[model samples]
Target: MGIHWKIKSFEALSTHELYDIMKLRSTIFVVEQNCVYLDLDGKDKVALHLYGEFEGKIVAYSRLFKPGISFENASIGRVVVDANYRERKWGHDLMREAIAGIKTHFGESKITIGAQLYLKKFYESHGFVQTSEMYLEDDIPHIEMKRESC
Candidate 1:
């Protein structure tokens, strides 16, 4: 089977959809990573949510932000693919959709992301260039990356 992609605003998300999103995020960013930080940073209300559903469950997801929210340029954050689904290369698919979503929804040419240091090469493959030195975000080593409009 193939994955289905969907993009929606916070207000447009159904309660079940929102719950699944939060569950997936917590499963990855919290339990899997062992990170202890505030997952609900109060940004969801304004950012766009992009997710990939497989077998009726969200297996991949990301959040899109317009300029001036998380960075000076449009941004993509919370990029994730379910643990069981990593082998399918859905991370790349999620990013492709995210970049397009930013351009289509925000009319922005450039995008920035605070990516985990270990995944620098993965994000670079999508044209995101490292823009900042590594820093600690949520106790994880991270660096800022930027992808300019083509």
Candidate 2:
């Protein structure tokens, strides 16, 4: 038994599921990364949420947006894995599920992502190639990357 993957619309997530999602996100993106930025950017209302649970804990997650919501192409963002699960390839699993979800749900194959620079190769492995020069988002180096339809 590995990660139990779930993708839900904003209105479908239960209160407890939402809480766990936020807590895991803040733990990694805010506290662990030491970044002080608004976590609730108001986009979750229309985005599709993807989450993974292992041993009853939510350990991996990301959000997907339809075309014209986050970018010209359908996009994936807010990617994170529990600190404890990083060595187990769950990050890769999250992205694979997310990319497929975008295509399956949005009917789009081209996807864009604002990828942290340190993980450029990681995103590249999922077919994203850098499309913009380095820029700082929340004080962390990031680059725009896109994966075109195969």
Q: TM-score per candidate, in order?
A: 0.98, 0.98
lDDT of 1 by residue, 1-150 (tens): 899999999999999999999999999999999999999999999999999999999999999999999999999999999999999999999999999999999999899999999999999999999999999998999999999883
- lDDT (Cα, 0-100) at 57 in candidate 1: 95
Candidate 2 per-residue C-alpha lDDT over 31-89 given as tens digits, one digit per residue, 9 for 90 to 100: 99999999999999999999999999999999999999889999999999999989999
Off by over 4 Å in 1: none
Error of 2 at 134 (Å): 0.4
| Number of backbone-clashing residue pairs for each candidate, in the order shown | 0, 0
Off by over 4 Å in 2: none
Candidate 2 — number of clashing residue pairs?
Answer: 0
Error of model 2, residue 107, in angstroms: 0.5
